[model samples]
Target: YIDLYNENHMYWVTADMYFKANQMGLLDPETYTQKNEDYSQKINEGQVFYSSMEWDFDAGNAELSKAGGKDKFVDIPWADTAEFPAWISRASEFGMAARTFVVSSKCDETKMKAIMRLFDFLFSEDGSRTIMNGPKGITWDYDENGVAVLTEDCKQKLKENPDYLLEQGANRYLGLVGQDYDALSATQANEGKYIDLRLNKEYVEENMTDADKDYCDFYGVDVPLEVSTKRENQSTIHEGYINLMPAENPTDIQRSITKISDYLQQAVPDMVFSETQEEYDQKYAQIQAELKNMGYDDVTAYFKEAWENAISNYKELTAK
Candidate 1:
């Protein structure tokens, strides 16, 4: 999909393969299965890129160990000042662009300094501030103590129910109106004190760029309650049906093996032996239509409608 999309339109193609490759020392098996040929072509074409962010699982494990219990998981420090630059440099040597996720919720002097010269030209202080505070007073605030804070109500609601936060454009950090700074501040205040306690004002001030200051100027807009409610419900479903089952047990592992067997059994008749796209499409469409007729479409439509509405609501909230 990435190569197809990029080839059709010259967009910068980003993939998570670099991190996977770094951690596992190999390409992800799923990626190999889906687009090994295309990936090789893109590598030759110089169209593929890599991104590195906080090493979530590994960092979380480290934090758990430090805390001496599984009761608390730590947030990995933002990648901006971490070893991510070296990883990005390695990817660049392979003729790929490097992108990263930077968060302001936790700012430490050492990490900030490490990233300042390396990523300064690309992200700048303005960009970091924008990402961190989202137009400042609207979505976040500096209290009398000069500590960053989110609106109390927003923080409380999210703590009580995270679905509300995700639904109201809290997790949409890819484009202009991507994240809610106020909500993020609230999250940090509640769950990220470990990071905040380590931040130094001198480092933040010295490293900040004019653009970063500009990003801090705007106030955040409000998101609706309905959006949050729907997100919460979806989150519940995702946790119950998708995340928990696979992560905690071998149910999904067995199911996946079964699926592979079924696909192997079906592939010989469905693709390799078929002479044309028309033949494959005909058979696939027939099966798909049969499944839809058996209530697949109804269930899928319900999920799609909910997802679309949630996105629309988030956009609407962030528009202001």
Candidate 2:
């Protein structure tokens, strides 16, 4: 079939391709058996496959490239057809607004002043550093030239486990209220603060490990992971579908999405391992036909209208 590399089969591709993999006997035993609870743990135990079906764009890309002895890999988009809307090509300079609010009723004169001072510090360079690395001379400190550096002990812990220092209450002053990224979804712990606090690019680079510096040099980025992700997001061609879609989806739409996701989870492995091209195509067609039966047409129509409206709204605001 295609010269696909990663064979872990953990990351999902299309439903048809996945089903074909299972059919062709290409899927790992554990993929069907559900024995491995953690993909990273499986890799650590030497159970890694040849290629990945999907991965996180930031951390996953760099880590995989380094580990797989590959200089680079391209991110391929998933679509039923090659034809896509022109809006997909358009990049917006706008970003999600980081908001702050105050309770006017709760503020006395002194409380109002304190709140104002806090915001003032939060928006400053020093404030950003404080939020990112914590109070100076503790976990992190600045040199004579003002580049942030982690303490020796802090650096040691970071090398052992990425979250070791965080677990020890070092750099924990920022807390949940001040965290920049969504804490629940974030992989790297303290790194999220760099994006939220708008840490200086140079400051971030100064703290990068030698390996990370090499990674940056090869990738043409001046900063480390968190800053790199922020820069990429800023330059992204289109907003993510998740961001544009309704927060509380309609019941039918939710049901359709769940059905499609569940179906693909089971069907993709089989499609990927199909015995022959003819078999693969037959399975593909069957999957597409089945998709329609699973209310895909209704879901697609709903998203089409929603996406068009989102695009229109974005354009209207940008025009202003």
124-202 per-residue lDDT for model 1 (tens digits): 3233343443434544456797565454654556456634434544324423322222222223434322112112233
TM-score for each predicted model, relative to the true structure: 0.23, 0.51
- RMSD in order of candidates: 20.9, 9.4
Cα lDDT listed for each candidate? 0.36, 0.52
What lDDT would candidate 2 get against the real structure?
0.52
Residue ranges of candidate 2 with Cα displaced over 4 Å: 1-26, 32-38, 49-137, 140-164, 167-244, 313-320
Backbone clashes (count) for model 2: 29
Tens digit of lDDT per residue, candidate 2, span 1-320? 11112232223244445465566675565655554446545544445543444342334445654474443333333232323211212221232222334467866989888887886665444554555555557667655764455666666666666665456554455532233332211222333333232244444665565656776675666764433343322332454332454657799899999999798666755666667778866766677678788987788788788878777777776688
Best by TM-score: 2
